[model samples]
Target: MEQVAVIGAGSWGTALAMVLANNQHNVNVWSHREDQVNEINHHHTNSKYLPDVKLPSNLVANADIQEAVENAKAILLVVPTKAIREVCRKLRPFINTNQTLIHASKGIEPETHKRISEMIEDELGEGVHDQLVVLSGPSHAEEVALKQPTTVTVSSYHLKSAEIAQDLFMNEHFRVYTNEDVVGVEIGGALKNIIALGAGISDGLGYGDNAKAALITRGLAEIARLGTQLNANPLTFAGLTGVGDLIVTCTSQHSRNWRAGNMLGRGYVLQDVLDQMGMVVEGVRTTKAAYQLSQKLNIPMPITEGLYELLFDEKDPKHVVDDLMNRGKTKELEDLSSFL
Candidate 1:
C-alpha cells in the first residue's frame, strides 16, 4: 500500500483520502484543528466538512505536521488556494525532493495571480514543479465522499506524473484522465468559478438557460483568450477541467460560486455575499485577480471586466449583461487565433 500524506483535512482533502483508503493505501490526512483530527480518527467522520457521510475506518487525520509529512511517498495538497504558499513553506522544511505533490485546490492567488502549481514552483523553485501535478475537474466533495460517480482530470508537465495521478484516483465510481497541459488544466479550473459566479448571478436574476448557455460558451472563450497568453494549451479549456468544471460549477446545487453569485444577482453586496458564504467564495477573489491580469496582459476579457464591476463597483447586473451582448461583433473562432 502506498503511504500518502494529504496536507489538509477540509472536505476535498477528506474526500480524496477516502478515495485512497478505499483503494487500501495508507493515507495520512493532516489538519490544523485538534478537534477535526480527533473527529476523523475517533469518529470516522469530518462533520464540519463532510456531514452524514461515513468515511472508511482506516483513513485518519493527523494534527502533527511533521508526523504527517515524514516518509510519505506522495503528497496530496487540498488546502484553499490562498493558503498554498504558507502550506508550502511549512512543507518545504520536511519535503524530500522526490515526493510528488498532487494539488487539488482550485483558485488563483490574489496578489501574484499565480496558479497552484506556479505557487508550488515559486515555493520550491528550480525543478520542483517537474514533480508537481494538478488534480481538477467537477467532482464535488459532498458527492465524492459518498463514493458517487465522479470524473476528474490530472495534469502534469511530465506525462509520468500525470499517469501516476490517473492510477492513484481512478476507480469504478471515480474516473480520472491525464493531460500534459498543466497550464491549461490549472487555468481552466481556476477561472471557471468566476464564470460560475456570473452564472449564479444570472440565475438569481431569473434569466433562462439561453443566458446561462451563452455565459458558459462566452466564458470559455474569454478564459481561453487570457489563458493562451499565459502559455496554457487552448484545447485544455475544451476538456473536462475547462468545460466539464464550468458545467458543474455554473449549474450544480453543490457549487459555492453559484450560491454566492445567486446572492449577488439578488442584489447583495460583495462583502455580504462573502460573509454569508461561511466557506471560501473563491470566485470573488478570482474575479479581482483575473480583472487585474487581463489589464496587465492586454487581453480583451469583457466578461471578467463586467463581473468585476458588478461584484465590487455596484454596477447594475442588467446593465453589465447588456454591455456584454452589445460588444463589437466578431467571428465565433476569431478570438482563438492566438492559439494558432
Candidate 2:
C-alpha cells in the first residue's frame, strides 16, 4: 500500500483520505487546526466538514506538515485556491524526486489568473513537472465519504502521471478516468463553479428549471470559448470535467458557490452570504479573476461578466438576469464553429 498525504483537512481532503485508506493505502491528513487533527485521530470524525461521516481508521491526521509529507509517496493538494501557494511552499522543503503530486482543488488563482496546476508548478518548481496530476469532475466529498458511486477525471501533461493517479483513486464506487487535456480539464472544472453560482442565483430569484437549464447550457459554451482560446481541446468540454461537472455543481445543494449565489439572489449582501456559508466559495473569487481573464484574452464570457457585476459591482441580480436575456443575439455556434 502507498502512503499518501492529503495536504488539507477540509471536506474534500478528508474524503479523499478516506478513499486512499479504503484502497488500503496509509493516508496522513494534515490540517492547521489542532482540534481538527485531534478529532480525526481520536474520534475518527471531522464534524465541521462532514457531519456523521466516519473516516477510515487507517487514515491519520497530522498538525505537522513536515511529518505528513516526509515519507509520503503521493501528495493530494486539496486546499482552496487561495492557500495553494502557501501549502506548496510548505511542502517544498520536505519533497524529493519520484513523488506523485495530485491537486483536487478547483479555481483559477485570482491575481495571477493561474490554474491550480500552474500555481503548483510556480511553487514547486522541481521534482513536480513529471508527476503533476489534476483530479476533477462531478464528485462531491459528502457523497464520496458515504462510499457512494462517483466518477471523476484525472489529467496531466504526462500521460503516465494521469494513469497513475487514476489507479490510485479508482475503485468500485469511485471510478476514475484519465485524460491528457490538462488545459480543458482545469478550465472546465474552474469555470463551472461560476456558472453554478449563477444557477443558484437563478433559483434564489424563484426562476425555474428552464432558467437553470439555459444557464448550464450557455455556461458550457462560455467555458469552451475561454478554454479553447487558452489552447485547450474543445471536445474535452463535452466530457466529464466539462458538461458533466457543470450540471452537478449548478444543481446540487452541496455546492458552496451555488449556495452563496442563491443567497445573493435572495437579496443578501456578498459579505452576508459569505459569512453565512463560512466556507471559501471559489466561484466568488473566480468570477473576478475570470472577468479579468476574459478581457485580457479577448474572450467573451457574458455569464462570468454578469456574475462579476452581481457579486462585486453590487448590481442587482434581477438587473443582471434581464441584461443577460436582452443581449444581442448571434448564431449560437459562431464561437465554436471551428471545432465543429
Candidate 3:
C-alpha cells in the first residue's frame, strides 16, 4: 500500500482519504482540529463535515502537520484555495523533494486571480516536483465518503502524477481517468462552481428545469469561451471535469456550491448564505475571480459576470437572466469550435 497524506479533514478531504484507504493506501488524514482527529480514530465518524459516512478503520487521522507530510510518498492537499499557501508553507518544512503532491481543492484564489495550481507553483517554488496532479469531476464528498459510484479526472503537467493519482483513487465503485489538459481541467473544475451558483439562483428564483437547462447549456459556452482563450483544449471542457462537473454542481442537491447558490437564489444575502451553509461556498468567491479573469482575458463570461453582479454589484438576478436570454442568436454546437 502506498503511503498517502490528506491534509485538511473537510468533507472532500475525508472523502478522498476514504478513496485512498479503500484502495489500500495507508492514508493519514491531517486535521487541525483535535476533536475531528479523535472522532476519526475512535468513533470513525466525522459527523460535522462528512455527516453519516463512517471512515474506514485503516484510515487514521493525525493532528500534526509535519507528521502528515513527513510519512508520505504522495500528499493530497485538500485545504481551501485561500488557505493553500499557509498549508503548503507548513508542509515545506517536512516535505522531501521526492513527494508527489495531488491538490484536490477547486477554487481560484481571489485578488491574485490564480488557480490552485498557480498558487502551489508560487508558494511551493521549484523545490517541488511538477508531479503535482489535480483531481476533479462530478464526485460529491457526501456520496464519495459513502463509496458511491463516482468518476473524476486526474491531470498534471507531468503525466506520471496523473497516473499515480489514477491508481490511488480508482476502485470498483470509483472510476478515475487521466488527462494532460491541466489548464482545462483546473479551469473547468473551478469555473463550474460559479455557474452552479448561477444555476442555484435560477432554481431559487422558482425557475423550472427548462430555464436551468438553458442556463446549464449557455453556461458551458461561456466556460468554453474563457477556456479557449486561456489556451485550454476546448474538448477538455466537454469532458468529465468540464461539462460533467457543471451538471453535478449545478443540478444536484448534494453540491455545496449549488446549495449555497440555492440560498442566494432564495434571496439570502451573501454573508447570510455563507453563515447558514457553515461551509466553503467556492462559487461565490470564484465568480469574482472568474469575472475579473474574463475582463483581463477579454473573453465574455456573462454567467460568471451575472453571478458577480447578483452577489456584489446589486444587479437583479431576473434582469441578468433576461439580459442573457435576449443576446443575439448563435449556432448550436457542442463547442466543437476547434474542429470546425
Best by TM-score: 2
lDDT of 1 by residue, 153-215 (tens): 998888888887788787898999998888899899989999999999999999999999999
User: Largest lDDT belongs to which candidate?
Assistant: 2
lDDT of 2 by residue, 1-340 (tens): 9989999999999988898899999999999999999999999999999999988889999999999987888999999999999999999989887788999999998878999999999999945887899999998899999999999999999998888888888999999999899999999999999999999999999999999999999999999889988889999999999999999999999999889989988999999998899889999888988999999988888999999998888999999999999999788778555256
lDDT of 3 by residue, 1-340 (tens): 9999999999899999998998888999999999999999999888999877878888999999888766699999998887999988888778776788999999987788888988887878865647689999999888888778999999998888789889888999899999999889999999999888888889998999999998888788888888778788989988999899999988899988888888877878888988989888888788889988889878767778888888988687788888888877767764436323
Clashing pairs in 1: none
The true-versus-predicted C-alpha distance at residue 289 of model 3, in Å, is: 0.5
| lDDT on C-alpha atoms for all candidate structures | 0.88, 0.91, 0.86
TM-score of structure candidate 3:
0.96
Q: What TM-score does each of the candidates earn? A: 0.96, 0.98, 0.96
